[model samples]
Target: MRFIIQRDHLVQSVQDVMKAVTSRTTIPILTGIKMVVSDEGVTLTGSDSDVSIESFIPKEEDDKEIVDIKQTGAIVLQAKFFSEMVKKLPSDTVEIEVQNHLQTVIRSGNSEFNLIGLDADEYPHLPQVEEENIFKIPTDLLKAMIRQTSFAVSTSETRPILTGVNWKIENNELNCIATDSHRLALRKAKVEIDSAAHYNVVIPGKSLNELSKILADNNELIDIVITENQILFKAKHLLFFSRLLEGNYPDTSRLIPTESKTDVVLQTKEFLQAIDRASLLAREGRNNVVKLSTLEDKIVEISSNTPEVGKVVEEIKALSVEGEELKISFSAKYMMDALKALEGTEIKVSFTGAMRPFIIQPINDDSILQLILPVRTY
Candidate 1:
């Protein structure tokens, strides 16, 4: 196998595929990257059994050559060393040639290195997912959706399903929900797809986060295909595959409160800043709890006190505080995370009671919703 490729493109492609490679895999060959040189282009693949990524660099695009293929063949090289070597190669182009006995030589700008390559045939084949049930979403919206909800996934493995974000698409509406049991984030968006499209899947939060890091923030649509056990995301010159979680995601709809006992409208920024300041003292507390109480004339007080540390108290004026007066204690970190995820100037915080879960949502927009269970401080 021999190919001369542009250095910049090679570096970028290597970085993207490296996200899927891991050193702790049971299959030894999975530690290396599989490279296939063909007549059409060069394909690089990396996988850790759970997640796999593939990048294809065409021989030429728009009459400009990207890869000059000398011989059609395949090789597997150690991912860690090969990636670092390609990044630091001192040349505009790098030439890679596989010699007898699986010996691979890399050369660029008077720098030459030989690496013992593994046979590409030893690499496990990626799952073959049919593209019949396909859905499309814009890259930027997908990234935003991941950012807004992935954080809420449970880190604990006791209930494995909660470690992933539940994705449900039906009637052209996409709804994503993630929760660690203490807090929940829900994001909704309209997808342009065939009316008959329907799917319910659980995608690992870690995989989504890694995918988000590699996706370009653009209006380009990403084609998604779902099967019985795997989900494939196809982008320009890239293909990402992730194994679906095995269990059915818990029903989260019943968890959201339908009615509010008290509702307060406040500027999102001011509330976030007040919570941030109050958390300084709360951080020293075991639960990191901050208290919020409604006062007369639409004033809300934010306070936190730790015995070892001084207390913090601040008051912020709300646009309107209606219904019964409320006092709720919750983790400051949870509140701040929810506030940052919400998109808008003004937000409505609804409380069912001092002991029940409360919701924070952007005023007049139902696309995003956040729920935090109040911490018991009694």
Candidate 2:
């Protein structure tokens, strides 16, 4: 295989695919990235069984040439060394060639290096997903959904399903939910589809996080296809595939409280900053717990005390406080996370009781919601 590609283009494509390549893999060939050069363009694929990413660099885009292929062939090269070489190449273009014995040579400007290559045939084939069940969503909105929920996924691997985010689609709406038994983050958005379909899939939070980072903030639409065990995300010239977890996600609909004893509306930033300062002391405690109580005339007190450390007490006036007055203790870290995920300036926090789970959501938006389980501080 032989190809001549621009330095910047190759570097970007390599970085995108590198997210899927793992340094430690049971299969030896999984550590290498497969490169295929055809008449149309050059394709680079990286996979580690659980996730796969492919990037295509067309010969000409917008009537400009991006790659000049000298021969049509394929080869696999060590991902780490090849990526580093492309990034450090001191030239506008890079030339790659592979010999009969799988020896790969890369040259750019005055630098040239030889790397041991593996046969592309030994690499595992990516899952083939049919486009029959496909939908489209804006890249930025998808990234937002991932960011809002992926952080809440359980880090413990005892129950593998909890380590993934649940994705459900029904009636043209895409819902993403993640929980670690202590808290939950949910986000919903409208999608473009031809026919209605209901899907329940659990995707690894780590994979979604990587996908979010790779997605550009442009207005381009991404095509999503779901199969029985795999999900595919396609952008302009990139394809991302992930294997679905093989277990039923726990039903979380009943976990949200239906009633509220106390409700307070406050600026998101104000509450976040208050909790940030209060947590400084709470973090030193065993549970990182902070107490919030409603006072007369709509004043909310944020306080935390540690016997070995100092105490912090602050009062922030709420936009409006309704229902009965209540005091609750919860993890300051959880509260800060929920606050940061909120998009609106004003947020409404609803509490059913001192010990029940409370919800934090935007004042007027019903699409996004966050729930945190209050910590018991006796």
Candidate 3:
């Protein structure tokens, strides 16, 4: 393949695809980025088995030539070296050409480098997902949903299913839930769909994170296609495909408590900061547990103690406190994560009891909920 392309566009495309490229991939070709030059444009593809990303750059856009293709062909170049070389190229235009014996040459300004390229035919093909079940969501809302729930996915691989976020669509509403047995995050949104399509799938949290990072924060629509074992996200000129995690995700609906023993309303910022400060001491001890105790006159005492380290206690006046008195201990990190995800001026925390899981949600918004299992402090 031979093409002279704009340097800036080339760099952006390479960077976007690089998120899927990994040196640890067992397949040698998977570690490289595949570049295909055609009459329409230049397409760059990168895959690491679990996730695949393809970016296309048109030959000419808006009457300006972005790529001048001399020959229509394809080559797989080592992503590690190629990405670095493209970034350091001294000119605004980049020239790439391939010759016999899989030899590739890249030239820009006064610098030129020769790289050994692999036959693109050996690379594993991206999953061919037919347009069967498809849905669309706003880019900004999708990103927000990912941010609110992906963080709650388990980082451990022991329970592979828990490492992904569970997605369920019914009644034109999409519900996403993630939990690591200790803390859980759930977000629901209404979607536009023609058929009454109901789907329950678990998508890798890592894949969602990378996809969200690439998506722009706008109201533009993103097409989502779901197959048996793969899910495809189409955004403008990019196509992202991720393998779905096998096995049924545990039913988490039963985990949410129905009755509450105590319900307290507090300022989100104040509560988050108190937990942040209290966690400093908890971090020196065990699982970063912070304690919250309800006091008279609507005061909530947040404290943490470690025998070896100093203790911290802060009193924050609640907007209102009702029901039974409560004292609960939970992971400060988890609590802070939920609070940050639910960004609002006021929040209502409902405690089932001192031992049972408690929920933290915005006062006015019921679409998002965060639950944290209390830790026992003897």
Question: What are the runs in model 1 whose C-alpha is more than 4 Å off?
Answer: none
* Candidate 3 RMSD to the real structure: 1.0
lDDT (tens digit, per residue) of candidate 3 on 1-378:
788999999999999999999999889899899998999999999999999999999999999999999998999999999999999999999999998948999999999999999999888889999997789999999999999999999999999999999999998899999999999999999987756798999999999999998888899999999888999999988999999999999999999998898999999999999999999988988689999999999999999888887899999999999999888899999999999999689999999988899999999898999999998876
- Score each candidate by Cα lDDT: 0.94, 0.93, 0.94
**Model 2, span 1-378: residue lDDT tens:** 788988889999999999999999999999999999999999999999999999999999899889998998989999998888888899999999997759888999999898989999888999988889789999998988998899999999998999999999988889999999999999999999765698999999999998998999987999999889999999999999999999999999999888898999999999999999998987877888999999998999999999888999989999999998899999999999999988999999999999899999999898999999998888
Task: Tell me the TM-score of each prediction against the true structure.
Answer: 0.98, 0.98, 0.98
Model 1, 302-368: lDDT tens per residue? Answer: 9999988799999999999999988889999999999998889999999999999989999998899
What is the C-alpha local distance difference test score of candidate 1? 0.94
Q: Which ranges in model 3 have alpha carbons more than 4 Å from their true place?
A: none
- TM-score, cand. 3: 0.98
User: Any residue pairs clashing in model 2, and if so which?
Assistant: none
Clashing pairs in 3: none
Candidate 1 clashing pairs, residues 3+ apart or interchain: none
